[model samples]
Target chain A: EDQVTQSPEALRLQEGESSSLNCSYTVSGLRGLFWYRQDPGKGPEFLFTLYSAGEEKEKERLKATLTKKESFLHITAPKPEDSATYLCAVLSNQGGKLIFGQGTELSVKP
Target chain B: EAGVAQSPRYKIIEKRQSVAFWCNPISGHATLYWYQQILGQGPKLLIQFQNNGVVDDSQLPKDRFSAERLKGVDSTLKIQPAKLEDSAVYLCASSLTQGRFYNEQFFGPGTRLTVL
Candidate 1:
């Protein structure tokens, strides 16, 4: 069975605080790992895709690193505008379908 | 280019009623997907289509759910005799192709269905 689990179901961070969200997965054959940010009342926006272990990707204030069994989305000095639910998904080679985590709800208070 | 588009941002209905949602994927995208996202959970793929052909529908509940991608452009997902557990956000996404790598799906705003 392929499963993805995200930890720290909810996190409240003050503005300019840094934190990391975790996504662990168990899949038959890993193809890719994806990170997305979803805001209230809007669809999810693509963040990054890590294709292999030891791979890392970064955006303005976000960085994502991958390992053999898990991935981490590190937010550096996040701002209130950066608050959103971060989603993690893994694409398995067997079905070519993305198995998603429950997501981590992040709220940055100003 | 416009992103994926979904219709009826929100809908409220009684159980056992029928409803349908529509999706228009990004122009020229070869792959389309429909997902169900319950509150507090990530989106779950219900079906996948590649140029009007069903690539995957293993997760879709065929007893009450049916989807069609006619003309390889616009798609529709219908739920007949909806159940209370069917209340969730129906999201549509698209990608350039279903390649093994570099397949990033772009999502739509989604249609929120509330069944009572």
Candidate 2:
């Protein structure tokens, strides 16, 4: 069975604090790993896509790194605007459907 | 470019009633998807369509749930005789293609359904 799990269900950080959210996945054949940020009352916004292990991608204050069994989304000196639920999803070669994690709720207090 | 669009941002209804939600994917997108997201949980795929052809609908409860993408540009999902457990956010997403490789999916604001 393919599944995705995210740790630290909720996190609170200061305006300039840095932290990392984890996403662990188990799938038959990994095709891609994705990260998305979702704000309250809005849909999720795409962040990054890692196609293979040892791959990394970054945008502004966010960086995402991938491994064979897990992925990490690192937030550097996050601001209040960065506060949102981060979701992780994995696409398997067996199908186009995405297996998603429960997501990590982040709060960056300014 | 405009993102995926869904109508009726919120709906409240009694159990056993029927309801429907609509979605218009980004222009030129060939792949569309519908998902059910319960509060505090991840979005679960209910149905997927590739250019008006059904790609997957394994998780959809056929007894009460049905969806259609008549023209391959827009889609609608209907739930008849809704149950309490069906109260959740129905999200619509779209991708450029239904290929083996990676295809980024764009999501809509979603229709929040509350069954009383």
Which candidate tops TM-score? 2
Q: What is the C-alpha lDDT profile of model 1 across B3-100, one tens digit per residue?
A: 89999999999999999999999999999999999999999999999999999999999999999999999999999989999999999999988865
Cα deviation at A26, candidate 1, in Å, is: 0.8
iRMSD per prediction, in order:
0.6, 0.6
Write one digit per residue (lDDT tens) for candidate 2, span B2-111: 99999999999999999999999999999999999999988999999999999999999999999999889999999999999999999999999877566789999999
Could you tell me the TM-score of chain B in model 1?
A: 0.97
**How is the predicted docking of candidate 2 categorized under the CAPRI scheme?**
high
Residue by residue across A44-81, what tens digits does model 2's lDDT show? 89999999999999999999999999999999999999
Candidate DockQ scores, in order: 0.94, 0.92
User: How do the predictions measure up, each by TM-score?
Assistant: 0.98, 0.99
RMSD of each: 0.8, 0.7
True contacts kept of 2: 0.91
Model 1 residue B70 CA deviation (Å) reads 0.7
lDDT of 1 by residue, A24-91 (tens): 99999888899999999888999998989999999999999999999999999999999899999998
Q: Whole-model lDDT, candidate 1?
A: 0.94
